[model samples]
Target: MSLARRSLMEAAAARFGWRRAYGDTTQVDALLTEQTETAYSEAADHAALATAKNTDALHLQPCVLDVRGRVLGDALYLEGLLSGARARGLAPELIERLEHAVDHGHELTVLLADTVRTTTAAHATGH
Candidate 1:
């Protein structure tokens, strides 16, 4: 495993108070996959909620923008991690998952932009 990946795994273990088995590549891979999925899932849910029509988009604009920024930053970080994984010849599935997470962030950005525009228009028209 790459140093970056190993460090991330170790940090996660520390944060979660989980025991780490030294030199266990399988466990490292599993933890990476699970963490990637969980982060993506949470970002996806937040994006959906922020863009939902029933939401008070106008009132939530600041918070939504902050979340969008965070998601984009996370996607960029994942891209770096993906590069490291590729260089290290990691599993194809893990690389694919990283790509998916990055794509989701990009999509969320677009969705948030549209929602903000619609909300701005509605507010201007006194709707």
Candidate 2:
């Protein structure tokens, strides 16, 4: 993962008390998928922010896992950005900023997850 993303994830995790675990990538992936769908759908519907409910399930995912579980932390950060934007009463431009933040977080999570998975696979194969 890029250092910037990693740093952002670490900061977000610390802010939210996410425990880094070694086996949470799958869950994190699931959360990201859900968040991505929600964000896209919400944008498609052009829903007003005040009336919109967040992709609750994605936000509720457990973040207190090992290094493997840190994907959920990234997902949570993205969710927070979305929720924050919505909570701010949805000024059009602010909403756009929130969307960008969430997208960035998702990209970082994917990179981190890929790295974790590759490293784990290499170790398993005794590379």
Candidate 3:
């Protein structure tokens, strides 16, 4: 996870007194695969990011991961994911930003869930 993402998760956890986020990893993995592929095909943002990553590293799988991460790293995405992660919150900004991402299967919900879980684990064990 990036430092910025970790910080965002930490901020949300502290602000909301949230516990560890839990979800079905198998489902998440499947969804991530399907949605990521879809994003790669459909989302212009993903193409641009992937191209940028390719130019940066000229690698393969890692570049794909970076593209997804970049899409999820958007402030609007993080905000929406963070808000949805908690029991009570919603970000209008995120809702507005969703026009391109969710429709394109960014799997942002799964990303948020994973990010929440990572943050929870870090806080739980003092890692």
Whose TM-score is greatest here? 1
What TM-score would each prediction reach against the true structure? Answer: 0.56, 0.37, 0.23
Sort by TM-score, top down from the best: 1, 2, 3
lDDT value for model 2: 0.64
The better-scoring model by lDDT among 2 and 3 is 2
Question: Over the stretch 11-113, how does candidate 1's per-residue lDDT look in tens digits?
Answer: 8989998866647888768878978988998998877875775465477767767777887788788889899999999999999998888888788888977
lDDT of 2 by residue, 4-92 (tens): 78668978998998956546888678657867987898875655542365243222122212433565576677688679778877788
lDDT of each: 0.80, 0.64, 0.59
Error of 2 at 22 (Å): 37
Off by over 4 Å in 1: 1-57
Model 2, residue 1: displacement in angstroms?
37
- Candidate 3: RMSD to truth: 17.9
